[model samples]
Target: MSNYKPIDAKREEFRKYLEHAGVMDALTKVLVSLYEETEKPEDALEYVRKHLGGITESSSNTDALRKELDESQAQVTELKAKLAKFETEAGNE
Candidate 1:
């Protein structure tokens, strides 16, 4: 039949259509961002919307910086405890 085609051929045509629509690039970026997230978003659609809506990088950077600051603060607390223990031991000696 003239209308018959292999599944791979149909898939290739669909891929071409998505590429032509610029969806391939946008989808790739969104997927990469999603994959790199340390804290997976609760609302997947909202995350995708914010990313696709041309929101600036500042928001993402802010999130990363905040997480870094929290981790640093925790490390400082641990170091402080270790220092306190060392001081106590030296005082006993």
Candidate 2:
């Protein structure tokens, strides 16, 4: 059986984040140029590994970034919920 798997959905999500964050477009341009010059996928991958090590260093960093953003959003949501609760309590008081 073929063992190929599709790209991770998270990768696309992160790629979108990078694009919005102004990293994906730059990486795409660099990787495309390298691919054209080398005519080799491995070479282009190596170029990305070396040149864009910031994003590829570890999954932890990616997870941490994602988690951090999520936590910040959660905090905002929790604060809003608490504020509403407090407002209700004060109204009752």
Candidate 3:
């Protein structure tokens, strides 16, 4: 059904968002380690941001990413519920 397409798309988008989150988390860890070792958080942050394009001087990107990550997670949960319902119905038929 047409409705299924949107769910599928959202699921795929959520997967991408999770992947991005994982990458961001890794970068954060790496930056933290560098900062601790070098005693220069600003330098480490700058290096990390430079290596990972799309991170601007402002915190807007971080906020947006967090929001998108949360939205994606919720969408994935909804998609899973829909999938379970569809599977149950199919099994009953």
Candidate 4:
């Protein structure tokens, strides 16, 4: 019976952590939105996935990031080439 106190404290601490992290609020909002829906979605899990910000949205963002990465790489290569050219000219002088 005495051992139960530590377990209860640990559970409460975890609950507080989740609340501080905004997880509890996000969940409450998602649940409220789900409850408020008029025509219930057939696949509840999919609905939850969409409400929580779907993976598809992030995947779409990858395309733009990849383009930026490629452009940055090209810029780095151009700068390195210029640096090498300047160093070679300085050495000759």
What are the clashing pairs of model 3?
none
Candidate 2, pairs of clashing residues: none
Among residues 3 or more apart in sequence or in different chains, the pairs in candidate 4 whose N, CA or C atoms overlap within 3 Å are none
Per-residue C-alpha lDDT of model 3 across residues 13-68, encoded as one tens digit per residue: 88789777786566676666665764555565576665455433346777888999
lDDT of 2 by residue, 1-93 (tens): 899988799988987898898787768866776667745565656777755765445767878999999999999999999999999999998
Please list the residue runs of candidate 3 whose C-alpha ends up more than 4 Å from where it truly belongs after superposition. Answer: 1-57
Question: lDDT score of model 1?
Answer: 0.88
What's the ranking of the predictions by lDDT, best on top? 1, 4, 2, 3
The deviation in Å at residue 81 for candidate 3 is 0.3
Steric clashes per prediction: 0, 0, 0, 0
**lDDT to native, each model:** 0.88, 0.79, 0.73, 0.85
User: Would you estimate the TM-scores of all the predictions?
Assistant: 0.45, 0.39, 0.40, 0.53
* Model 2 ranges with Cα > 4 A deviation: 1-33, 36-60
- Highest TM-score scorer: 4
Model 4 off-target regions past 4 Å? 1-7, 54-93
lDDT of 1 by residue, 1-81 (tens): 499866798899999999998898988898889889999999988889888765446677878989999999999999999
lDDT measured at residue 2 in model 3 versus the true structure, 0 to 100: 54
lDDT per residue (tens digit) for residues 5-53 in model 4: 4558889999999999888888788888999999999998888877777
